[model samples]
Every structure is written in C-alpha cells, then in structure tokens.
Target: MTTETRPPAAPPRVDTSRRTRAPLHLGWWLAAAVIGLTLLNIGSVVVRSPNLDWSVVWEYFLSTDVLAGLARTVELTAIAMACGIVGGVILAVMRLSPVPVVSWAAKSYVWFFRGTPLLVHILFWYNLAALVPAIAVEIPFGPTLFEVDTNDLITPLLAAVIALGLNEAAYMAEVVRGGLLSVDPGQTEAAKALGMTHRQTLRRVVVPQALRVVIPPTGNQVISMLKASALVSVTSTPELLYSVQVIYNNNFKTIPLLVVASAWYLIVTSVLYVVQHHLERRFSRGTGRG
Candidate 1:
C-alpha cells in the first residue's frame, strides 16, 4: 500500500478570492436616506435661516442674570432629587411591607400623586398658602411646638423644589419597587436563613442590589426633573427659562433668549447622558460578556 500511495489528496477549496455580495436590506437603505435628509435639512436651517440672531444669543448666553438663573435651576434639581430619592425609598419599603395598612397607604400615595398631572401639582403647591395660611407642629388637643407662615416657607425656589420633589417621589417609588421585585426571592430567604433581620437584609443586601436596576430610570427622572424645573417659570421662579423670559420681556429679544436657554439645557442634558451611560456600564459589570 505504501508503494502504491497516490499523491496527497487534493485540499478542499474555499475559493477565498471570490467575493459574494451581501444581501440588500431595503429597510437599512431607507433609514440611511431618511437620516441623511434630516441632517441636510438641519444644516440648511442653521446656515440659511432668515432670523436666528446668533449675536444676541452669544452676548446674553453667559450674562449675570442668566448665570444666576442657571445656578438656581441646578440647586432646585439637586434638592428635589435628594428629597425624591429618600421619600421614594421609604414609600417603596412601605409598599413591600408585610403589614396591610402600610402597603395600602403606600399604594394610595402612589395612586394619588401619579394620577394627578404634574402641572396641576405645581400650581397647587405654589398656591397652597391660599388654602392653608400657616403650617404648625402641634400635638392634637395640646400645645403647639412651633409654627411657621406658609408664605414665608413657600418661596418661589422652595415651592418649585417641594412640588417637583413630592411629585417625583411617587414615580420614584414605583421604580424602586420594580427594582426590588427584580431581585431573587431566594436571596431574601437565604438572608433570613443566615439570621438576618428584615431591616438588616433590606439595608445590607436588598437595596444595594436593587439600585443597579433602579439607576437608569432614576437618571431619566433626573433629566425630566431638570426640564420640569423650568415649569416653575410659570410661578416666576427665575430659573433658566424664567431668566430668558425676563430678558425677552425687557428687550423684546424672544427668540435669541430662547435659543440661549435651549443651548444651556442641551449642554447640561448631554453631560448627564454621558454620565448615565458610564454609570450603567459600571453597574452592568459581571452581568455580561467579557
């Protein structure tokens, strides 16, 4: 057999040189064309629009009043978000409580706040003094500890924060509850088996894990809160949009001031977008491929 061995069997051919065309995707081509046209339209508008006063926008973009208003916006967003996060966590805990009354109260809270329009909430909070002129800390049928005038407490800034924070708490509660539900029940059981108390398990084990699921929506809510803070302008709160309104009211430069406000909002939201993306990637670690 060795003496009669033929030349090595010919290698199978792959024909690497011959190129095959990729299958055409009409949907992809249509999407590309649409996007291209949209970009072209935006370019044309930026280049050729009749009445975009770039000079005025540039001049007033960093003016003192606008800066002050922007600062106020940031302050309101931070305070409101802090309040929302704390309150929401409590509400979420209440919703998940073993007691029926606690669960009912939490559900009722979410139902009422989520059912109402945010604008209405804002107006209601801004005008709350009209209904109750004073808020007090007092024992029922006993002496008052302290009292404060509602008007003194509800400054424009405070009103905006209160409205946004309280309203945001309802939504945050649902987000937190959903996140909590996503965690495995077996983990809770295991914690209990390990002799962990309910509060200890929740604080040390549950909430930490739940936060990964909750963060993305929380970021979105933060962005929404940032924009919603502008609605305070209706109450003349002197945030970014209100600052622009003040300028336009004085100089009759409506469009430019709006553009300045728009620019600032776009800038802030873009930064937040980047921050959210990195945070999500961080939290997703060990949960995905190498």
Candidate 2:
C-alpha cells in the first residue's frame, strides 16, 4: 500500500516541449556541389579548345576501323581474363600448398612478374622467340622428346595473350589468397569434422565464401585488363590503341583519334563499373542485416 502511493513515478519524466531539428538533406547539397563542379569542368574544356573540331571527334569515333578495333580489344580482354582466372587459381593453390617447393615456385613467379613492369614483360614475351629459338618438350632433367620452332609456336597474338594472362595471374593469385584467408578457420574445422577432406572443404565451403571476397577485386582486375589490352598494340596486335595509332599516323588527326579510343575505354569502364556495383550488392545482402 505504501509503494502504490509513490506519486505515479513523476509522470514518467516525458520531455514533450523539447525541440528536435529536422534531419539535414546532405544528398541535395552534394548534388548541387557536383553540378557546380561539372559545369566548371565543362567550361574549362571549352576554354581550352584551341582549334578543336567536335565534328572530327564524332566522325573518328563513328568510323568502321575504330569499331573493328573496339571488337578486337573486347576479344583480347576476354581471352586474357579467362586465362588469368585459371592460372590464378592454380598459382594460388601452389602458393598455399604445404610443400615448400611448390610454394617457393609460386612465390618466385609472383616476385619476378610483379617486380617487372607489365609493359616490359609484354615486350620480353614478344621477343621471346628470338631469345629462345625452340619450344622443346622434355621430362624434367631428361632428354628432349620434341621441339617446335619458337617463332612458329608463338605468334604475336598468342604472345600477347600469354604475357597478359601470366602477368595478371601474379596479381590475381594474391587476390585469391587473400579471399581464401578471409574465410573463417572454424568453417574448415567443421567441414573436416563432417568428414570432408581438405580439398573438398576448400572447394565446397571455402571457395564459395571466398568468392564473396574475391569477386569485387576480380571485377576491378577485369576493368584494368580492359585498359591494359592497349599494351598489345606494342606487339602489333591491332587492338584499340594500335588501330587508333594507325589512323592518326595516316590522317594525322591525333587528338580526335585519341578521343575515339578514350570514348570507347570510358564506355567499357562504365559498363564494368555497373557490373561491379551489382556484384557488390549481391554479396553484401546478408552482411548488412545483422
């Protein structure tokens, strides 16, 4: 009876008169700032156009040769990325192997390839036919079984693919390794307790989870590969930059031809960015709710 007479708990101390400021719309301010910056940039470009002809730029981009070059650039990127993914998985496994020799070999490969500039690697591979006169097949520390002329075996296109794929693999191995490392050790333990072998656990439990980590960086790498395909021009593979160069060399409209190449690169990069965004969202779905 005494506890019931406690003055109704002071009306629960409700602060009804307190004023709350409305939440600021920072997004609107950010949009305005972006618009201002874009206008400034456009003004600067217009001001800097000494003897610029917009028509020539448009014409160059619309040309059949430029379209052909774009197609070839797409082809090179597809081939290189496919080869890179396969090689990267192999190298990543090698790097993670319990055997010291396999790990050492993988480490050495990454070291040498990553230490050198990719452009240099491309050039070296292009000239590898001269450096190594024959492509010989033999058992380790045994007599040669067969030989093919290096120049015949390695075409410039093939050389470009090999160089791009091998170089990308060095970088991609690290990406994959990082993804694999991110998976919880407990998951592997549980998989083993459930009678899964190491390889089976890795393939089933580890890689699926690792893919969530691996895919974003791999998308970025694909975008980078798209740009790096230009380097194939050095080997006369007639990719986008090479085709543009050929056009400019003939017509001497260097700026316009470059603009064409830049436009295509921009378009491709934009598409890749869109793909990356969706992929990141897909992977992030379950992560945010908890």
What local distance difference test score does each model get?
A: 0.90, 0.89
The clash count for each model shown is 0, 0
lDDT of 2: 0.89
Structure candidate 1, residue pairs in collision: none
Give the alpha carbon lDDT tens digit for every residue of 1-290 in model 1.
Answer: 36776899889989989899998899989999999999999989976776777888899999999999999998889899999998999999899999999999999999999998888888888898999999999999999999999999888778888889999999999999999999999999999999999999998888777878999999999999999899989898989999899999998988888989999999999988999888888877777620
Tens-place lDDT per residue, model 2, 199-220, is: 9998899988898899999999
Which pairs clash in the backbone of model 2? none
Q: Name model 2 segments beyond 4 Å from true.
A: 1-50, 138-146, 197-200
Candidate 2 — number of clashing residue pairs? 0
Report residue 136 deviation for candidate 1 (angstroms).
3.5
Candidate of highest lDDT: 1
